[model samples]
Target: MEENLSGQLADAVAQGADEADLARARAGDEAAFTRLVEPLRRELHAHCYRMLGSAHDADDALQDALLRAWRGLARFEGRSAVRTWLYTVATRTSLDIVEARGRRALPADLGPSSDRAVLDGNAPLTDVAWLAPYPDAGLAGDPAGPDARYEQREAVELAFVAALQHLPGNQRAALLLFEVLGFSAAEIATMMATSTTSVNSALARARKIVAHRVPPRTQQRTLRRIGDARVREIATRFATSLERGDADALVALLTEDVTWSMPPLPNWYRGIEAVTDFAVQVPMTRCPSWRHRVTSANGQPTVAFYLGDDAAGPHAAWSITVLTLRGEHIAEITSFLGPDGFAPFGLPASLP
Candidate 1:
């Protein structure tokens, strides 16, 4: 009972602080506005990434949303918490972007997988808006909400975010707000400026679609089961195998149904045979040398690859390869090619 009372006291204190900040913000104190929003920015950015598949797009959407909130501060009637108000602004801003740009896609979504290694100089699909990886560093420990269905990191999983791209803007917003963020139906209805019935319908449709696409088990669960040391060993072995051009070593780590995709390259290979063919023929053979740094993306193990022609020469950034594992074996390898993905992860442009 004492613990419960102490918790209630903390909440009351926080609420009072927020009220003071809100009043100052409303009176055109920019510093107060910054103070009010700074705490929520990271989670808000993650929310934007879920809404829009690309972290770059999320950056823009969040900036625009914050600007909108700052301009409309006078209209914010203290009826709801500041976080909810910011989310409402962010969600609506993201919906507008979704409408204008449409959804991002992975190479697998474009066409059927190639049965053999694509030897031809397959050019990157510059025209397509491809899905980008999220840098999930410092995000794993933060709590979403007690009522949230998906954990904070689970919501940003590549498969989950990619599935969200398949949803319509309204349905996507409703689902993220209700399921991932744990906003109530009535609250979502208000945020979305729609009826509760409409929000319910959207949520139902969104859930059905997401359920079909997303895997039954989340990467977080898999990582926990595998343990941190083992997971690191797997990532290291995979990266080392690639760097050493050890095809046999690489093949040993993969599941029979493993998939290999390089986006914005249109061709993707599925199954061990096809993936092995592609790996041996391309990165292991044609590409001269490779250097890698293990990283994390979308709550999955990742490797940042750098390629160089001369073995001793500086290797330039190549792809951010995100590995999706099923048990001890890797089930999917999504290598998001090009240097654009490196900066977000704070990866160096080249390796000496």
Candidate 2:
């Protein structure tokens, strides 16, 4: 009887061992994958988000990377470890989505801008499309120990993203791969299935184009050193004035030459007076009880405003407000709130 019992106990242990191997094989070991991915997820998401420029697309791309990781686990062969493989999958997928013309998207909040808008009689704006903004809060680099990421921060601002739209796709990919992702030209060539010479040439051309587009943020160097509280106070005041429908007060806070725009909308009002005019005419006239929740969005200082309150919660985080401050005054306001934006901003679709 004792011998028989011991045999049964041994059989049970063997079964448990078999199950463990099977679980590992399935890539169904959630705890292990979590540990593998946790460290790099946020940064990876940022890369994908910048590449795609939509939070929803970034989320999807991340999910796709995860699934691909699961499927390709056996082939991982420990050559590059999990992280690099994930990055490789991520970049290829982002490039594929971009190159395939399959996953291109723009914020639903912003509409088209007028070609004839006067900017010092600037011959109608040539860049008509709306590019989404990124919040500075999500930047992967350290904010302290200061070489000052002035250029880098400006590079991710709402305005720069708009400039990136003008580049051809491959140049865009190459520039992002080299500059933002910190990948080698040879590595990019491997990823793109091209020659090093080809990648280098593309990088040079991309640099030239982006150089012309990136206006030196002559202000950012001094701007970054300012205390955070002082800046937040100014932003808060502007938010309060905006919520009160007091355009005069809002205008008082804005620079005389401030540029105001809403994505997916054709009208772009430049100068404090013009912006004030539009502010008085729209929004305040119709939407009442609009509430702004301060949150980091699109690598900038942003507020997610909800237009109306439903019984359960706020419905559809309407607009992500990106404020560009030059000293104490706001210079550029870009509100990107297009259709289907709630998901990207991590907001609920409908209030209960």
Candidate 3:
């Protein structure tokens, strides 16, 4: 529907001036509506993701926001920039979704770190609100706005998103609007239908929790410091080591306090010894075959792996592992094990 309307909006633009397009859009021209919102789509979607912590949830919230914006377009009095108004709608919609469901979480949030690997792992918890990975493809990486605190990529990093989930819905919305998207406290208060004092208080509380949780340097900054070629080299080395079941090679890539966690399976291992022991027992000794392709997730390196045997034919989809780096060393490995992560990468069900 947006595509069809966008095409019509293009035709309308070809016919006249900017004023004409605005008139058409206000008069319910779907094409004009599309044109008005298209420029803001990516940022708005990102806002929803920050508020909700799941790309899937962000999609739903964004769609609802657009719909509401369309219906309310006639009431738009030109008091604020269209972008600001749209964000207001998107933020409110995300808050609604948060109320209905809840914030998503990582496995580490569920319980203490396992000293040893839980051999069979645990069953996939359907009811557990697990944090979903974001696909970085097609993102423009543009800054949110002039006053935005975080770059587009920085806002989506795994650590940042996970920390956001820890805040309450209102505080989360307030912080994103003020710090991430660059809205002023007074402006955000208007958007949320509250006082500036309340918005400021929310921002302060949200920042405290996030500051406590997130690492000092963002993944974006670290990736830039390392450069792209070195980033790929590190990810490729880890994948190759895993495929060959080379425990030593794998350990060589890890930091002394490296951590590995496979969500939906509550157990996670911390430190070099625990991680290496888990790797040797499970992925190295038990899994007969492995294949991998390097990918990106949350502005950091990721590896999508397949596991099976030669005789059984093609390998089956396994995990989408995202590595967290502390300089050149692999600090954390979040292998999102399940078919759920496979689809986002467009991976085949089996590899022959």
Candidate 4:
């Protein structure tokens, strides 16, 4: 009972401090505003990424939202907590970007899977807004609230984010605010400037689409079940197989129904045979040499590859291959190719 009382007292004190900061921020104290916002920044940025499906877009949206919040600070009535207000601003900003830029796509979303390696003219589709992987460093595990459905990390999984791209801006915003962030329908209606009925309808439609696309079991659950050591072993062996051009060793790591895709390439291979054909033809035989550093992306085991022909020369950044596991086998290989993926993971452009 005493501990409960003490916690309540601490909350009251923090609220008082925040009230003062709010007043100062409203009065144009930039430092006060920074203090008020710093605590909630990471989660808000994640929310933006979920809404927009790209870390780069999330960065721009969060920056624009914070700018809007700062400029409009004087108008904040203090009815809601600062976090709620900021989320409202961020959600609207992301929605605007979504409408303007449209949704991002993966190679699997483009068309049918190829039965064999796409050897010739397989150029990156520069025009398409591809779904970039989120760097999970320092990402939180807690849900936004008690009512939130998705834990923070689970929500950013590549499959979840990719599924979100199929949703319209309003449905995406409504679903994320309600399910992922734990806001009430009425609250989401206010944040999105829509009716509660509309929010409910959007949630229904979004849930249907997402349920169809995303696997029932989340990657977080799979990783937890598989354990860290085993997961690391699988990722390392998968990378080693590529580095040594060992097709049989690589095949042993994958599921019979495994898929391989390189985004912006507009071609994907499904089933072990098709994936093997691509692997054997391209990375194993055609590519000269590979060096890899194991990493994680979208809450899955990932390998960052560096490619170079010369044994003594620097290996240039190639792709960050994220592995989605089913039980003990590798089920999906999403290699987000190119250097743009490296900077977010703090990986170097090239390795010697």
TM-scores of all predicted structures: 0.97, 0.73, 0.91, 0.97
| lDDT per residue as tens, model 2, 1-352 | 9999999999798656544543575566766666566666776776676567666666788888877877776676654435456777787777666665433323322444333333343232324434555555456542221222234455566555554555666677677767766667777786677899998998789778767866565335435665567667666777777668887778777998887776655467777667776677656555565666666554455666667643245555567777777767888787776536555555555443
Per-residue C-alpha lDDT of model 3 across residues 1-352, encoded as one tens digit per residue: 9999999999687646545666788998999888878877877877787788777888899999999999998998878877788899999999999999988988889888877767874677778888877778625544566788888788888899999999999999998888888889999999999999999899899999999999999888888999999999999999989778899999999999999988777788999999999999988888888888889987889998888885356888888898899898899999888776777666776688
Q: Residue 120 deviation, candidate 4, in Å?
A: 0.4
Q: What local lDDT score does residue 238 receive in model 1, on the 0 to 100 scale? A: 95
The lDDT for every candidate, in the order shown, is: 0.92, 0.63, 0.85, 0.92
> Residue 313 error for model 4, in Å?
2.0
Between candidates 1 and 2, the lDDT winner: 1
- The stretch of ten residues in a row with the least summed lDDT in candidate 4 is 137-146
**Model 2: number of clashes?**
21
List, residue by residue over 155-206, the lDDT tens digit for candidate 4. Answer: 9899999999999999999989888889999999999888999999999999
> What lDDT is reached at residue 256 by model 2?
84
Which is the winner by TM-score between candidate 1 and candidate 2?
Answer: 1
Of candidate 3, the 10-residue stretch with the lowest lDDT total is 137-146
